[model samples]
Target: MASGCEKGEKVQVGKSDLEEKILETATELFAEHGYVKASVRDIAKLVKGSNSCLYVCFKNKDEILFRIITDVGSDLLNELNKVISKHDDPVECLQDMIFTQILFSIGAAKKMKIYLEEQYQLPPSLKEKALDQHRQLYDLYYNKICEIEKQGLLYQKIDKVVMTFGIFSNINWVYRWLNPIGRLSVEEVALQITDMLLRSVLKNSPLST
Candidate 1:
């Protein structure tokens, strides 16, 4: 009798809450005192776990850093996919992407800071792989923008590469100054940014109106 198990299905095993706490502590430590300066002992101590426990979860500091980067990237890509899949209209898709990204940035500001500022501190091979992951993300935005243009929604013909870069620059860097405890909530800020970007690109959406 043939069972129902498939060959290519991916099984996602959830991590323990304690392990999640360890990663959270590590993110704070790395952000506070650069990735290279933050030691595994510091992370273990803050997580209230022994060095051996960290070793059980991660091989070394390098593995921890890679894991943090990989985890955040995976989440962002998954969310981006969801936003992309939900909308048939490219303009709405990009707006949702911007809003979702802002919410992600606000919620994971510390992790975002560490991911952006600490990439070079990773080992050479690891750094290369991490950067390649980043490039893949960039390509996603580029392709999305290109698809939008193909629909003739853009008012003018602009360079796709430069436009993609511009869009990322216009949105992603907000992590540097966004305040979670500030006057505006994450949803509010995301709405404003989404409006700003959508008005910039959509032919029917004007900035002044």
Candidate 2:
């Protein structure tokens, strides 16, 4: 019962299981300890296995880091999809999507931070896989902006691609200091972020009474 996990409820202890556990553990460990400090032994201790088990499952530490990078990118992609599934007004919908994405990313800051900070350590193929998923997620948002732009719903002069990225950059940086239990609510901060993004990108001028 490594990590004192109960049997059955405990993760399996074979090569396949060890691989999965190591990846999961490493995501957290890397967040807590960072890539240079977190080693195979640390991950093995949590999975009821040995360093040899990890080597069998992964060629090396970089490979394991790569896997974690892929997982986090997939998680963000899923969040983006979930946010857009609702069919609200394009303006409101995009705002909601940005807000939801920022809050969720903040909630998963440990994973997100590790994935961002350690991605460079992964081999080229691993970086490509993670980056490809990231690009697709951005493309989804970018294309949505383009569609709305065509409808005269979003600004035509402002580059949809650049605006989408600018919005993401503002929201993503919050994870550096945000707290789930902090004085500022995640939603409030996210809403403010949306206001800033919308002010910068909205095509239809705000209505004045």
Candidate 1 minimal-lDDT segment of 10 residues = 1-10
Clashing pairs in 2: none
Q: Give the alpha-carbon lDDT of every model.
A: 0.76, 0.75
lDDT of 2: 0.75
Off by over 4 Å in 1: 1-18, 204-208
Q: Model 2, range 1-209, lDDT digits (tens) per residue?
A: 45323334533455566667777888888999889898878887776666676766788988888777777778777777877777656666677778878887887888888777777877788788878887887787787787678678776677767898897788778899777787888888887777878878875535311
What is candidate 2's TM-score against the reference? 0.83
Question: Number of clashes in model 2?
Answer: 0
TM-score, one value per model: 0.84, 0.83
Model 1 RMSD vs true structure: 8.3
